[model samples]
Target: MTRLALSALLATLALIGVATPASAHTDLLSSDPANGASVPQRPTRLTLTFTEPVPAESATVTLTGPDGAAWPTGEITADGATLTVPLAGSASPAGPYTVSWTVESLDGDFVDGTFAFTLTAPATQQPPVATTPAPPPAVTSADAAPTTTSPSAGSTATLDAPPTTGTSAPAATSGDGDDGGVPLWVWILVVAVLSVIGIAVGVGLNRRAKRGAEPAE
Candidate 1:
């Protein structure tokens, strides 16, 4: 009877866990091109902002243009909520440029999104680093203008099908469940099952003690 109780308890726990929901870190925010800023030329770098700080080397941001090409020079560099990417050349002929990014939130869940900005005109030259001419005011992209970004033919960011948003859903993982990733339902189920086991053990021991005291047999 005690064993049956334990088994039933375990089964009940599994069902409860299934009924509950799970979520991932969300797509919180960004800060590149201010969402709707106009640029006269393409800048040498692209930057993105997030609600939480991301790892310096763990985040990736891609910039593509209207002609279906990639513009990012290298990997992104992170500092707090900021992630920056350098441009390969100046920028291609302008229109709208798309900046898509994937970042690992402080909670360790990856979230991604794509946003775009319009460029008015070509930049004559890339911006100089801190070493030169007071560094071109830093107001906007001055060198490359009237440019746009689009997905290249073989770019991974390009969607053959439609893109699925990275909402609060938890993605299945391959590691042992303890990736600090036990779901809320998983934890609750574990606790309930343990409690039932404790109760059954207590009741079974009490019944055994009572039976041992029988008068004749």
Candidate 2:
């Protein structure tokens, strides 16, 4: 009976040891921006969520950015099952960012973890500069001189022309402008009307003369 009791006690002790480690250790459930996530903009803060609540003072977080520079952060805070670390300012020279964290759960178990995430390059803005298109290079007297030209003695080409005067005949009208000539179809219609009127007048005169010739008829 003594041996059996001793064996039972040992078995109980083994079970208790196994249960303590399992309950004491906390698991990292998730993180802000997520682990191994590619972020398109600079992240101002980091958040970590665990399977269980962790003590605020026992939590520690460190960050490394591109070029392995240490990123400054504000005081860490804990709320229930989450921990948040705020960056000092906007991150620069975007690239890979690594975060290391350690926390002590409420059960006094110390847990540590590391994760990597990437930051997309920030957009660079180019301010528009007011440029007055370099004032068309000033025209100098030398530049205004006409290029050399040679012509045969009898050439009729002349560059000079008499100045226009108000009395001068008006410039020839373009095809698009009105010219005073009547169209052929209009003139034909006018001639046909005149012919018809002349024929009617002649017929009336003939009738009057015939009646006069026929006497009392």
Candidate 3:
């Protein structure tokens, strides 16, 4: 009986050692942009690596802005032991940002943690150096308008202005005998008078023929 009791006690002690470690909650091993680091700019993604693999659906990461407002976040993805939480929208405002994360370990236990970091407004950006486009490379006298330099007063050299061609003016004619023949109006009037005389003669001949054709009475 004494030997059996000792054996039982040893077995119990071994079982307790194994069960205690198994039932313990998971722990965070490290983080990207590490805990308490001073980042020059806000991070777009937060990474949490754990001692064991956690379920993606069971993971939740919340980002709190400097003003204590909740920052938007996208779906969290679990790849092996790493949980990647994508930050939605633009970078968090310049100041202290807080990350709070909760995850369920493979053993169905919930583990939660919190971390913080500073963002320094990206160094003021320097206003982009303001390139003035180099002022279009000063136009020289030779390049502008192609001016021809006149000869100096004491020098014998001379540059004459280029001769301009003049277009000839239309010919001018005197009114006398300007028309080569009789005027068109006079010819038209003569033709009209002749047509009237011809019509009168034809009418007189028709009346005489009717008189001759009548029977004697």
lDDT of 3 by residue, 1-217 (tens): 9999999999999999999988988888999768888888767788999998889998899989888999998889989999998888764568888889899976887899998888877434335676666667887744544335556654444345454568766897656446676777788899999999999999999999999999999
Candidate 3 least-lDDT 10 residues = 154-163
CA displacement after TM-score superposition, residue 54 of candidate 1 (Å): 0.9
lDDT of 2: 0.83
Give candidate 1's error at residue 159 in angstroms: 80
Rank the candidate models, highest lDDT first.
2, 3, 1
Off by over 4 Å in 3: 122-217
Residue pairs in clash, model 2: none
Greater-TM-score candidate between 1 and 3: 3
- lDDT (0 to 1) per candidate: 0.73, 0.83, 0.82
TM-score against truth, every candidate = 0.43, 0.56, 0.55
Model 2 per-residue lDDT tens digits across residues 1-217 = 9999999999999999999876767889999879899988878899999999888798999998888988898999999989999988653667888999999976786999999898887645568998886667888854454443456654444344345577868787645224766667777899999999999999999999998899573
Query: What is the RMSD, in Å, between candidate 2 and the native fold over all Cα?
Result: 19.9
Query: Which candidate leads the pack in lDDT?
Result: 2
By TM-score rank, best first, the candidates go 2, 3, 1
- Cα deviation at 182, candidate 2, in Å, is 63
- TM-score, cand. 1 vs. native: 0.43
Clashes of each: 22, 0, 0
